[model samples]
Every structure is written in structure tokens, then in C-alpha cells.
Target: MTATASSPAIIRGATLQPRPWANGLGISHNIAQHGDGACGFGWMIATAELSGDAAFSHYPGIDRVFTIIEGQGATLTLEGSGPLRCRPFVPAGFPGDQATHCTMDGIPGRAFNLMLDRAGWRGSVTAQSLAAGHRMSLRATAIHCLAGQLAIGEDVLEAGDTMLPADNVTVAAQGAAAMALVVEVAARVG
Candidate 1:
């Protein structure tokens, strides 16, 4: 299904807290999730802080992408695949059904995670910094503010806020240090 254009949803950093993960070794703050059904959702975004090494929960028929937000990052060991290095700001994608294991590299860190139910949708996430006078096309379905301030016309977004921009809307950054994570979602193909 084609996505309908809508105003972005904004989440404030100060009004949130970390909830326990399924594994109980970490905590996460849900940023947003879109989809409706009795049993499942199409996509979800969250911020998590890992306090120790642990096994990740497995979700069949889903895809997960993660990016480090703070600290020294971690390593992911997929059940059947080689280990993956998760560094700061670099997004990594993997199957959610895999028996994933986590190992803290140095210091505990926070990460941004995007999960898509593969039976209905697929998506990607990337980090970017926009400065004043820099024009950017809001091609992604959602944008999450990571740091600093950004203005889309009269709408302003600060850290921890998420928004859905109109397709092809070109806007310039209002300040320096405006960084964000862009999430693009699409229907799954056969």
C-alpha cells in the first residue's frame, strides 16, 4: 500500500523513560510504531540502552536495523552468521528471526532500533546532519531528531522528536548541529 502523506509525530525526550526489554538485560524507550491489527504492527522505532551482554529476542518474519546513539557500541552475533560491529551512528540491518547475541564492546551505549514486520512492510534508517541554508528533500517516511534544532518552515524539531514529512518537500535547516535519523518505509513485495 502506498503511504498517505501526514504530519510527523513529535516525541519529547524529557517526557520519556526506559522500559525493560524482553530479555530483561536492557531498557528501551519506544519512539513510535505505526500499523494496526489484533496481533502485530508494521513498523516500530525505539531507543535502547544496553547495560550488559545478553541474548536478543527473536521475532520471526521481521527485520531489524540499529544504530548506536551513545557510548562505545556493541557487537551482534547472529545465530548462523558472522559477528557484526555496531559503531556509533552507522546503521546495521539484520533478520529479526535470527538468534542474536549481544556483547558490550567497551562502555554501555544507547542505540536506535527500527523493526519492520516483513510480512507487510520493509524499511531503512540513516543518520544525517543538516546545517543552516542546507536544503534537503523529505523523501523518507519519518525523521527523528537526534541532536540540535531543526525547522521545517515554521515547525521546529528538537532532540528525541519524530516527524513524517510530505513527499518531496524541500526544506532548509535553521541551525547548525541539526542531526536526525531518517526512516523510509514501503510495502513488502512478492
Candidate 2:
């Protein structure tokens, strides 16, 4: 759908193309991004499927938020910090320039990621749970359904579906308990 100030662009999860990760140990599906070209993105949202233990790619002057969405979680070792346990559905934020490594708990899993250029933008990720018919208005950059189903106007979003609302949008759970990740981003003022 064409997005306007009062409309939202709905992206089906099944339509995303999988791309190889920079570290070569994983693949990722791009959901949305604010800029183009290599090293030019002000912010980005994607989901990753890791294959094995590996070091994360370094992005100087950027921040990253990672959340395990499926399977068991992993342990992240970041430079200058103690080991951090990345639990399912819980977001972990860190400096993208930090020396970091990931070791899977057992089987490799999928994770949702948000990366923002520190000098240009700021962002946040929040998990929301809604009961059937519960409605709420959200002023967010994007909303990603994690489980169950959500309805935004006439559009119904399934698990993995993402919606980029041009303005504040009201959404409700369809039939059962639903969970989603809400992302909000804004340009940083000097």
C-alpha cells in the first residue's frame, strides 16, 4: 500500500529477501532502512538467522539493539563489559563499534535487530502484548508482529509482518493474545 501521512505501508514477512551477513555466519532479512548505499544508513531494522558462533561486524559510531525472537538465546561477549545473556524476547543494546562475539546456546536462532547511527538518529525498541480486542494508538516508526495476529484498520498482520505507519496508528489484537515489537526513531538535533 502507498503510504501517506494518514496511511501505513504493510510489509508481508514472506516477501523479504534473505541476504548474507557481513560476518558470513548468518543471514538477514531487511525490513526497512532510512538511507541507502554502503555505510550510509541512518537507521535500519532487520531480522537475522545465525548459523554458528561468530564475531559481530563492527560499525563505528552506531548503536545496536538485538533481541532473540526464536529458539534458545545466545551469550554475547562485548569489549569492556562482562558477558551478557541474550534471552528470548528481551532486547540487548550495545555499541556497534565494540568488539563482540556470539556463542549459540545450542541451536542457532533468529533475532530482530535495530541499528542506528549515533550521530544522526536515535531509536528504541519495545515489546508489547495485547489481549483480543485491546486497542492502542502508537506513534512509532514500525511495528513488527511477533506472535498471534494484529489488526490495523482493515489490515491484519500475522507473525513476522511489519507495518510502517506514516502517522499515529491504532491497532488491536485479532483473536488471541498478541505480541509485537514497536520501534520508534527520530533524527538527532545538534
Candidate 3:
């Protein structure tokens, strides 16, 4: 469930378990979390599946980024901002404490989520696609494969596999189609 700061961790999708939400509207599978769910955490990477509409859980002092990993995606209605349309591979960043609700894309889908404590850490999410014979410099903290396969360092990742790569590791596509979601999390600068 935890990895040292100096090493990378490979999280297999098959090992993840569905964690039911308090509201019972959706479920989340934690890929990596810094603290106990009952208490608080510094950062967290999770895969969430929503079958219908629901309000996002409030996390005070946290910043969150969400990317659609499957299906058509959804729409996020924020309190002050205009509605944000989230499509596959497009990551959206928002304040975790905002009064937010999501209207599903009429079909069940999953999203990759990153949550960081605003006071202690910050995070970003990006989508990556690579063609064969190309190399990608993976400086991000983690990556989740969405299509094809990637050879990152010594590991080969297929769709749904999450890898926390060492700093500055390089990645390459094994075939013609390779895509993933990259996440970077770091301590907040003063």
C-alpha cells in the first residue's frame, strides 16, 4: 500500500478493490494513498466509477485533478465557475472543497483521480500517447496506461496498469498505439 520515496511502485489493476463511497453513488479504487482513509492524507491516486449523477465528496484544503479513463465522460458543475465538460483523456483540475456535482455521460465510466493537500503538496495530470520507435521522457511521478503497452524502465505496462517511475525515467511504446495518463505530485513551495 506504500512505497518509499526513492523507489517506484507498480500497481496492477487486478489487485485494486472497489471502495464504496459514503453516499453510495459511486465507488473508488485507491492506487496509492499517503494516509489512512479514516484520517487524512497528503496525496492519493484513485480510479472511480460512477453509474449515475452524484456530488463529489468534499475534501477541505485539497486540490484535485480528474481524467476520464473510459466512456464518454461527464460534466462537472462548480459553484462559481461555468460547467466543465470532462471528456476521455482530458484532465480537469479543481478545488476539492468546491460544491461540485457530476452528471454522468449516460453510460457507466471510470476516471483517474489525483488529490493533493493544498497546504503540503500540489499535483498535475496529463495524457500521453506515443508511437512506436519514439521515446518519452517520463518525469511525472506516476502513469496509468489507457491503451496499448508501454515499456518504462524494466516494467511493461498494459492498459490499466499504474507505474510510479523513478525520476527522469524514459518510456517507449511497444507497438503503434500507446496512451496513458501521467500524474505529478510534489511538495508545495513556500
In each prediction, how many residue pairs overlap at the backbone (N, C-alpha, C within less than 3 A)? 1, 0, 0
- Give a tens-digit lDDT track for model 3, residues 89-167: 8999998888899998879788999998888888899998898867888787788888889898678988889988766
**Per-residue lDDT tens digits of candidate 1, residues 1-190?**
2333565455667677778877676788987777842127688888887777888876777789989888788899998889999988899999988999988888887888888988788889988878765868778777788888767656687888766665655555666767888888887778
lDDT of 1 at 52: 76
- Native-to-model Cα distance after best TM-score fit, residue 4 in candidate 1, in Å: 7.7
Minimum summed lDDT over a 10-residue window in model 1 is located at: 1-10
Count clashing pairs, candidate 2.
0
Task: Specify the poorest-scoring 10-residue window by lDDT in model 2.
Answer: 32-41
By TM-score: ranked, best first: 2, 3, 1
**Whole-model lDDT, model 2:** 0.89
Candidate 2 structure quality by residue, lDDT tens digits, 1-190? 2268766888899999999877666789999888532357889999998777888888778899999998799999999999989998899998988999998898988999999988888889989999988999999999999999999888899999999998888989999989999998888898
List candidate 2 segments past 4 Å from native. 36-38
TM-score of 3: 0.91
Q: Which candidate is the best by TM-score?
A: 2
Global lDDT scores for all candidate models: 0.78, 0.89, 0.84
